[model samples]
Target: MSEFTVSGRYKNRDGYRAFETTIDAVNEDVAREHVLSQLGSRHGVKRTEIELEEVGE
Candidate 1:
């Protein structure tokens, strides 16, 4: 696994909220999935509410 910095925006009750999170994954796809899963469960966000800005190691 590698360390990745993923930045994105998500919709909340108020509006859109920006987020930057670090994750360990094999690739960018996995990192994205991880972020989506976390945000969905933790923040009650839908997949369409999240927009990925950047993914970097």
Candidate 2:
């Protein structure tokens, strides 16, 4: 597994909210999916509403 620093934006009551989080995954694609799933479940945001900025170690 690798550690990834993922940054993105999600919809919020105020507007779009920026977020950054560390995730463990095999690659950047998986890291991105993880971020999407997490934010979707926690924040009730759709995949289209989430904008992925960067994914890096």
Candidate 3:
């Protein structure tokens, strides 16, 4: 697994919220998906409301 830093923002009841998180995954694609899944499950965010700004390893 590789370490990735994912930074993005999502829409919520209030407004747009920024987020930055670390993830361990095989590649950038998986890392991105992991971020989306995490945000969705934890914060009730939808994929359509997410805007990923940067992803780096």
lDDT of each: 0.95, 0.94, 0.95
In Å, residue 29's CA in model 1 sits off its true spot by 0.5
Better of 1 and 2 by lDDT: 1
Backbone steric clashes in candidate 2, count: 0
Q: Can you write out model 3's per-residue Cα lDDT over 1-57, one digit (the tens) per residue?
A: 999999989999899999999999999999999999999999997899999999999
Residues 1-57 of candidate 1: C-alpha lDDT, one tens digit per residue = 999999989999898999999999999999999999999999998999999999999
What range of 10 consecutive residues in model 3 has the weakest lDDT sum?
Answer: 37-46
lDDT of 1 at 11: 95
lDDT score of model 2?
A: 0.94
Tens-digit per-residue lDDT, 1-57, candidate 2: 999999979988899999999999999899999999999999998999999998889
Comparing 2 with 3 on TM-score, the higher-scoring candidate is: 3
RMSD of 1: 0.6
lDDT of 3: 0.95
Model 2 scores a TM of 0.94
